[model samples]
Target: MFSMDDFYKSGEVEEDGWNLMSSGGRSNHGWRSQSSVCWVGATALCLGLLLLTVIMVAHNTSAINQWDSKYTDLIHVLTKGRDELRDERDQLKIQSSNLTQELEALRSQYNDVVDSRDKLQEDIKNLHRNRTDKSCKPGWLKFNNKCYFVSPCGTSKTWEGARKDCQQKGADLVIITTRDEMDFVKSSFAITWIGLSRHEHEDKWKWVDGTFLDGDGFWQDGEPNNSDGEEDCVELSRSATAWNDVHCNQKFSWVCED
Candidate 1:
């Protein structure tokens, strides 16, 4: 066990031991210098790595914050767009509803206009018919452009006798030619014998002029459907604007011609 002070101060030494010491000291010195250089290089490398890591972290953080801000802005823009689209859709629905209601009202008005036009056309046709013909007397009962001669004979003859009486006066029994004439005659006369008769059959009817009763001026519920077989003449009753078949010999007011 040599003391460190005695080892440095000793003047006398073995030859081989001194050489070994000197070589060892030189090697140690060299190794210490190399270690110090390596340590310095290592410290510099570590500091550079730390600085690079700090720079990368700061760059990444800035990029992340920018991306987050862009994402938030995009989301806000999309949300606003959705809200605007919803509002627009609602407005369109309201407009469509209003338009539909307006269309219904227009349809109703169009129907009403069409009905009025039809009624006007009918009136115009009636006026033309009344104005064009001269067969009917100017001031007499005019119907379908023809004049009707209501019998002036006051209730004195049978229905058949009354019709024969009218024929002798140069006009056949009263024949209804149009709705206007029929309505006018019905309004004027309380009960009068018309040109309709059911002499041959119960339901069969014929005008006094020997023509088959084909028009709608016939009575409702068919012609001459009386219970007894004696009904052979049709008379317009005063109570109802309908025809009632009665016995041909029944006493009724007579109609005369002009």
Candidate 2:
């Protein structure tokens, strides 16, 4: 609230153009009085300063609001992008899990198929082994790669009849070719006709295969007397050590060798 009089008198100075008239009247001749002009100029200056401050405040507020809107929009976009990315990542993980499960199923199936194939192959191999291995028919005795069939009931037959039966069935009477064969045959049969005969020539004993039966002690002590001069069929006797020359018509069970 400083007054113009005090403002001017504090320094107590004056311009030379202004003259103090003797009649006590102002001399600086402008349109308005100095106090009136000063009041108007001060009012205008205060009003201009108020208007400038209001404009600056309005502009700054608008700028702040625009920045806030842009910031909000940017945040929304970033959040949306993150959400989409997360969703896509979750879908990818689910697909991967499904694929892994499918692959495992395929592997299990493949393994099962392989196992089945192996089992079938093993069975085939076993079948081949059974077919290829050396063996005998049912009820036949195997010895030295040959099969022998003894009469089941010890039924008797004539020598010619036994030989005919053996020949008809694709076999032959047991021939005592080796010691083991002779022992086996003699031990197995009580009395059985073998493949020995001398029907073609007298006193010249021969096997069915035309081999001469030399005197190698293959007889009992008193065997082959050729009583009645008709005994030509040789048979394994009960002594288990020799053969007996018997009449060809004698009935006895025989052994077959194949």
Give TM per candidate.
0.42, 0.46
Consecutive 10-residue window with the lowest summed lDDT within model 2: 15-24
Candidate 1 to truth, TM: 0.42
lDDT, candidate 1, 117-203, per-residue tens: 999999999888766755654435655555566655454578768777777766766776665555666765678777788767446
Clashing pairs in 2: none
- True-structure RMSD, every candidate: 14.0, 18.2
lDDT of 2: 0.81
Best by lDDT: 2
Off by over 4 Å in 2: 1-134, 214-217
Instruction: Report the C-alpha displacement of residue 193, candidate 2, in angstroms.
Output: 0.9
Instruction: Give the lowest summed-lDDT range of ten residues in model 1.
Output: 137-146
Each candidate structure's count of clashing pairs: 3, 0
| Best model per TM-score | 2
